[model samples]
Target: MNGWSNHLIVAPILVPLVACAILLVIDERRRVAKAMVSLASTIVLTAIAIILFAIESGPSGFEGVYLVGNWAAPFGIVLVLDGLSAMMLLLTALLAVASLVFSFARWHAVGAHFHSMFQVLLMGVNGAFLTGDLFNLFVFFEVMLAASYGLLLHGSGQLRVKAGLHYIAVNLVAALLFLIGVSLIYGTAGTLNMADLAARIPEMEPDRRMLMEAGAGILGVVFLIKAGMWPLCFWLPTAYSAASAPVAGIFAIMSKLGIYVILRLTMLLFVEGPSAGFGAQVLFYGGMATLIFGIIGVLASQALGRVAGYSVLVSSGTLLMVIGINDGAVSSGALLYLVSSTLTISAFFLLIELVERGQDAGANVLAVTMEAYGDAADEEVPEEQGVTMPGTMAVLGICFAACGILLSGLPPLSGFIAKFAMLSAMMGTGAIGVPPTAAIWSLIVLVILSGIAALISMTRAGIRTFWSSIEGTVPRVLVIEILPVMFLLGLTLALTVQAGPAMQYMDATIRTLSKPSLYIDAVRTAAPTGGDVKSSSSEVESN
Candidate 1:
């Protein structure tokens, strides 16, 4: 991390922050100007994320650390970039670009300061991914959540406001839990820096270690709620379903943010200490329950938006379960699944609004009634005839179908490839001669069943939205609105086509995560220039 690249480490956060300030000062009526600024800022963030990702991808993987105010870790603010954070940065940027572009159609104008809030949200997400300390992580989390509160209610409809209020109330409690957990951990470990905390955990006394674990468990609860774990996620479907299309699309990554933190902390804090294997069973069982719940929600959903919302739970549950597995080989596949499912779900959310556009409000109810009662049994059944689909309807239908295939883990898509990778990793090579455990078998069964459920639900929804409503008016969709969906879906296809390289990247990430020492060493040894850098916490203690 030298030269301009050192600055690149902070660009993702700064660009958005600056863009947000600029967007704020601009007249509200200049929507086009604001849109350009926001879009440009996001594009720059995307490019920076790409550069950082490429840096980490080098022959000798590099962890770029930007020491704020030229201060060392555990004493000063630091931003650390590794494979995991860099990958998350890229994912967030990509989703931001797609969602922002889609919003230009109309959603951006539905609310004042939409672009500013959008920038703030990006800044917070990027900062959360880049920050090297738990304290800053909390700061970024609040920033992200605050922006989400406004974004959730961006359109300001009755349903949006109601869902937004619930979303806010739930996350506020999570934030309070965050503060309590951080306080407990800091009191026990005497450090808020993640690397410092990891270093100190192993050396703590039994009682102190127990206290730390309790704090960690509480912290895990916060993330599990964000990850939409069962029982805690009752608000997810309603809130997400109520949000506007682009807001919902960008929100697809918000759940993954929780997963990212859980992955980061689980790898960095609990891997080597006395706390090893902490919260594994909770995540395992919790994830399974969440998956089952999501399956039920999907099956029971009548509206496309609600179905998309439940599908988010399905994605989150899979990731949580995979992380709980704690195998590097399995995590590699989980990473792939994370990216693939996110792209698919974001596309699905965007497509849902378009697919349901101009649809009769009672279409779903009528479809259900028709299915149950056989249409009066004798009301002169009309012979089926081929209908020429409009170009827009055809495109929406194709996108909807693509979403279904991806969500259901059907063949020839990244979703199937990801699930296959995990299953294969668990099964292992025949030469190993070790069979998977009953738990693994259970996971396999649940995963397969979830996919089947998604397929059935998606098919049913597709029939109601596309086929049964064939006589309905075609939606007036703009080229811009449809392109974002197409772009996101195309990425999933690219992931499928380039599964080899994508999995290679994920494998490297898993390798890095499996070894906590690598991350600890990188952060602890990072040096700053331009002034006298303070020694790390360990050096100060030694002195």
Candidate 2:
């Protein structure tokens, strides 16, 4: 929190923004140059994110709050980094590395400005996580969405174009809602700084508070739409399923962006005021419906891409449900689950294209037909033996199975550990003595059922793609292509092995988030590191 370390707080945003500008000047034909710049920038970001994560982890509470232009909070912009934002920054960086590396195999060259857009995306996502005010959050959100529009349509096809159009239209509306909400909240509170707003809400006049709540409610709708909550998620599956592999993989974290905002605002703005627990019921019921909808979508989906898309829904619903529970202990587990699911889904998105490369479009239909009726193979046919599996097929099969295990929340993976943590926290197993309520039990049932649904759907898809293909040909996958998938899955394995320390981190994170005063005080008291202006501003603010 001093000198250079303080500057690192803004490096995550500035690095990418500078890199994006550098990328914009490079010729489109210089693909390797562009890739190198993008990859180097992302790797540096990953390093900075790690350092920030460590700094926050070592601290007891909020520590990295940087005031912009030597101005005080409620007057100038600020960037705050605590356990939650640090973790998210690290997650986004990891995903960016994986996705960018995977794209270099071919996807990077398929469209113009892919590297530029990718860097812009990193800037936007990083900025969203770091910003200390709601208006800046909207600015970063729009930056993120604008970059995504190009990424979604990167490989320009009819399917991608159609999905991208729908994606753009929906998000544009969300952006508008975001603006109206911010305007109302500012109109009522006279400020947009989150910490200032949090401080004022408890003391606001009742009538103005009511208007603020209405604005917050509108903002919640916008977040839910981004989070892929049911009835507002009609566009997610199509848009996700149509993108190229790496783009889709990176896109996985975008949904969690919405979840991130919801968690932050709920903890900071509504934790202790008239707005306490505002929109909890809507989140609860909507999450339940979303879980059920995702289950149905997974079961009915024949395409692997669509299944991955629906799986995103399942992840979002579960997180929203956990938030609705409103327990800090439960939130710790939810954080673990969020990281595990995002990584798993990203790996799955990258793996899908490889697994289905050799299969015919009609293969799924034929497999279903065989399942409906009896297998067409003759009963007299002898079983084949000693037919050694090709190296490519074996590698793909292993990765695919790993994805299945993670997605289905099966044993011996981070996914299972995360869910178990949440369930245990829900059951009041450690230091928490409250019995499970009807709603908690219902969520428990849905969580288990969602796992089962995922298992069935993934198993079916796995068999059809790996076992029932008539071509029986291995895909022409390169080392660069498959390495990213394995690298991501490898991270999940690491998470599983380090669950003990990981949960400790989660526990500390929740402890910080559960106390709104920690965040509010950190932002409010953060002073600029300069000459007399900072001193004057600090003295005036104190008065």
Candidate 3:
């Protein structure tokens, strides 16, 4: 494969956008057309990701950069393909396909627009991952947000509408702040390209540097808000709970976008000078707070949907904490955890929806009575009368167990691999700035406690849903319902079995991320004009 082939980078993004366009023109009622387009596009995207990964992992070990339109960096748009972007793209493709499969049976209950919006959202997400410019990142964020608006309110129920409105309002504010931050940086640095900005930022004046730091600080808050960080994430649970199962699963991917950008930019562009160490502090404290809030939310929530929502919050917190530590090894672990938790939580949400549907069906059927004379009847249906489909229960049980295991970080699972990686990295001295003393031990203790809390809460909920007897017999599970859980669980197991390659991939990704020069060289060398600029710490600090 040609290293400079921009199509490899662009295909994953364009395919989905093109599919969304084609889906819009087709008849809305044609389910076959929708499924064909979605599934085909997903497969193509996944294949493209795999190809890109293979090419990068070839004898050269890494493909540095693939410039877009043969234009040089600091002037023309660039698309840099390295470890981080590849890993993110692969994960997004995999999860998007899984979520789409999960939605197959519920398509009729939702609508054609549901699937259309989903493809659009995927396009935005992939584009965000591949783009090398900050402005393009914001554009993709808006695209995804727009699609989410429709998906969040696909059913148009009162609760969905209310939740959607809140979600929109909060994210719009975050978007506005994001733009402001971009403008501040552009005004100070005269460029929006991440590579160029990084190269030029180190030479900036002290005051200007402080201003850039302030701007970055504000921008970090916006990302934290998007990631559902503590104190600012109150809207996530309500909004996520109200969305349809597939929509919620898709939404799960959205939060990671903000975190990914934060990690990428902070480590690459922001960690060059005196202020390099400060952001980590923010991440650490924010993570701890977010973790506490999530646990409290889980303890307080009674509904299944809300509990899953809280789990997302906790996971996001944990990720931030790992990132804040600034250890590549730990970051790799967090990356793995992010992928595993995403799948498990999404499966759990789907299972909750199934349980809700079964209960609702039974309640509705029992609420009314048939009569020959057509007289009004006032017989009330017991809430516990819903039949538990054995197949559905079995699948839900498996999904719930997967969720519990992932949350608890048990052995032989992806979560375990991820946690073990972080622990190993932490145990090694000189890996992070934090001293290896009682304080570090305390931090580890807190993390363990959080994991235990999540495990206990999730286990209790699983027992109630899967093992406890209701008033009626178990309902039959639809094949469609079981498909998503099976697929996700299978993937999780595969990750466990093939931990070596995956870890190698993650380590390679971390190495690439840690070294921004590889990315810079690719863009600079690929530029048609051959004007290469070296990044300076002072310039980055000022910008």
lDDT string for model 2 (455-489, tens) is 99988887777776767888899999999999999
lDDT of 3 at 58: 27
Please give the clash total of every predicted structure, in order. Answer: 0, 0, 19
Best candidate, TM-score = 1
Q: Supply the TM-score for candidate 3.
A: 0.88
| Candidate 2 ranges with C-alpha deviation above 4 Å | 375-385, 429-434, 531-543
Residue 47 shift from truth in candidate 2, angstroms: 0.9
TM-score on alpha carbons, each prediction: 0.97, 0.96, 0.88
Q: Estimate the Cα RMSD of every predicted model relative to the unseen true structure.
A: 1.6, 2.1, 6.3
Give the lDDT ranking, best first. 2, 1, 3
Models ranked on TM-score: 1, 2, 3
Worst 10 residues of 3 by lDDT: 363-372
lDDT of 3 by residue, 470-497 (tens): 3334655677767776787778889888
Per-model C-alpha lDDT, please?
Answer: 0.89, 0.91, 0.76
Model 1: CA > 4 A from native: 381-386, 429-431, 531-534, 539-543
* Candidate 1 CA-lDDT value: 0.89
